[model samples]
Target: MEITSVPFLNPEEYSLFCSFFQDFDNDGETSVNKSRKIDEKNKSLSEILEVIDETEIPTSKFEIPSSEFENRASEMGDWEQGRVRKGRNQSPATFHDGETAEDGGGQRRRLWVKERSKGWWKYLDSDECSDGEFRKAFRMSKGTFNMICDELESVVMKKNTMLRMAIPVRQRVAVCIYRLATGDPLRTVSSLFGLGISTCHKLVLEVCAAIRSVLMPKYLKWPDQERLQEIKTTFGSISGIPNVNGSIYTTHISIIAPKTNQEAYYNRKHTERNQKPSYSTTVQGLVDPRGVFTDVCIGYPGSMSDEQILEKSALSQRSKLGMLENTWVVGNSGYYLKDWVLVPYTHQNLSWSQHAFNQRLDELQMIAKDAFMRLKGRWGCLQKRTEVKLQELPMVLGACCVLHNICEMHNEEMDVELRFNLYDDEMELDSSRGISVNALQARDGIAHSLMHCK
Candidate 1:
């Protein structure tokens, strides 16, 4: 008798093989231990043949009854071998991560639960989900989501599934926007939205870029003459701030320290918040009287002064070229005084007219502060440290402003509690010098006009 080459066996088969030998040994030690010690000469030919017969019988019918097998083998295999490999065809009776495979009927099944998949989308569609919850998760109402989806579906819609099934455009956009609106970490967004972290990160940039490309021109722009006049009327009614077109301000959006030019993004002001060096980027914006952004200029380093940023802004260039002819865009003293751009009077020895002029300017300056407060409040992502890369931060900022405009247009009610509280730094008086002579005359003229109106 001889042992022949054996084919590969499943864990059950392998376990049965070991069990057969154990049963034979346990039944009688002489059949196992004594047989191994017997010399060839002392062993009878009949005994050798009997031993071979017993071994051949089990090997011939290697398959055991299903009743004979237990799940212990799978458990032991996992404990001893570290991980138990399962057949691709096996289906788990119960599924979750770190779960052990179980024998179901005649088939072995693995408990493989896919992570970051399902649940959220279905919950969003269900009646059990509340509008408040939806707004908290998505930062917009269902109507707004559907509205945006209709506009952006063409660009972000999936056309092919060659590599893997693409996530639906609505979910992709919702998850990304939720992340941006909440400023949550990628993992937090992934877990909450039921998406892979990498997928969340990719979709965030994809959706943000899509938003900027599609919505920027429509929502965020310089108002047309009619709209400008409308805005001017609103400002004029505020405190006789005549010919007022828009109010400009610079708000800082926090970001992680950049890999290159780390110092450039480092925010000198945020250092005291955590008692450590921090980084942020300045978002210079000009808003209409309704607290909607009309002009947005992002991507400047945090360390740059408002004067420097305004000097380099397209609005400044346009003003210099008479694009803003006979318009008054008021700003805080952080900005330099120009004929078109007006800032509050900063003289220590101020007359009654000058005081009245500064008072009116201060009232106008609240527009910028109120605009920023509402913008950050409505979209909380801007209120905290954003995790986007420096190169992509401008696009993210632009998309936020675009959405802010959308919310304003649709009369989206802001969450008062979520609004960013004004810090002392936000209230700091600007020390920029050198007002233009023409700009000085303009300020004095407005001041005298206010006095006469009084």
Candidate 2:
């Protein structure tokens, strides 16, 4: 038989393959060796046929998978004679940076492993990224965002490891802010940032810690004596009440049930309002005249009343030390009346003095209330059921408060669409009269002055 061509094997490779067979001789071989050589040659031939058969079989993945390809190759008449020629060139699958490709399923091909595509964060960081878009995503203006990055750069900046370069400080801050701003899960953040889920989670906690450590002292703290004088004067001018130190209020931050103490986090007020089981942690804040937080007490159980959190706060300790002597931070009925703390008369009375006092104090309390509203509205993570562990809530929430102060300081107005209505249930105290005789007398004096003097 004469061999002119064989299907599949390319022409250039066939000459060398044929020479190997041409050089072999069977004359000196034993019977067992002869048997082995015949079997090996037959096996090789069968394997070649198997491969050709696979290519010829129809598959939905390819347009021409059947005899069309085989017909293009030579007939069996040429292949049986031992001639082999090169197969047609196939379009190779696309590759990226040495990574695999998303090939249409081919039998011999390995499916590509894809890296997560980063979409949102890139758009946010680009030059075309509008300040409005940036603010919408992060709930703060670009200047405010840059300021935060600059403040936290020293603490939050990362070092590159041998495996991969570290995420930039800005990105770390963005991850934390995005998670807080959108209240999205870490997996959602991971997809947006093209980061691993665990990496996103770690970044959030680390950046929040950095914010608490570095920015909190500067932006969110007890106002100094000079600062207090300004706050009191401004607050007095607005509310018609003298020596108004700060406006105090408390709000609940919804959260998932903690692993160990689930019942403690259960929020009865919110659960009742929503007509379903709900859990939360409390955030008590005291804001000055400008709706910037002067002090914040965070991460107490939702079950704890406003007064309970207040008792545990540094503001309470400051009062005891007489640092807040002769001045009052006004609260709602949720808190007891005290020398440093003032509550409006809870009793029903026709007296003009009591009515005027409650009205003025309630007006003053709105400063803290509005501050909490913006805090939750801006950092949406505080408004939603956060996925972070219970122990981590304090730092995360504390960071949110600090950021809130910074935005307020920068006069960053929240987008109108992002405005959140706050509804904090205030439980009326059992007794309106507090233990402090001085506080009771002082309340009377203020109430009389408001009605009679003003």
Candidate 1: give its CA RMSD in angstroms. Answer: 10.3
Q: Write the per-residue lDDT of candidate 1 for residues 1-454, one digit (tens) a residue.
A: 3335644555664565555555445645665555563433234434544554556444555554455345656655656755535332354343322334444445555433465556877798577988888887766787888898888998888754222346788888887778767888888888876777898898988989999988888888888888988999999999797888999989888788888998887777778777998887888889887889998788998877787888888888888888788889998877778889888877699999999989988888888888888778777788777767778888888888888888888877776677777542543445555657888888889899999995
Each prediction's TM-score against the native?
Answer: 0.74, 0.75
The residue-by-residue lDDT of candidate 2 on 415-435, one tens digit each, is: 877788987788655673437
Q: By TM-score, how accurate is candidate 1?
A: 0.74
Report the error of model 2 at residue 371, Å.
0.7
Predictions: Cα RMSD each: 10.3, 11.3
On lDDT, the leading prediction is 2
Off by over 4 Å in 1: 1-117, 160-164, 272-274, 424-433
Which regions of candidate 2 are displaced past 4 Å?
Answer: 1-114, 432-434
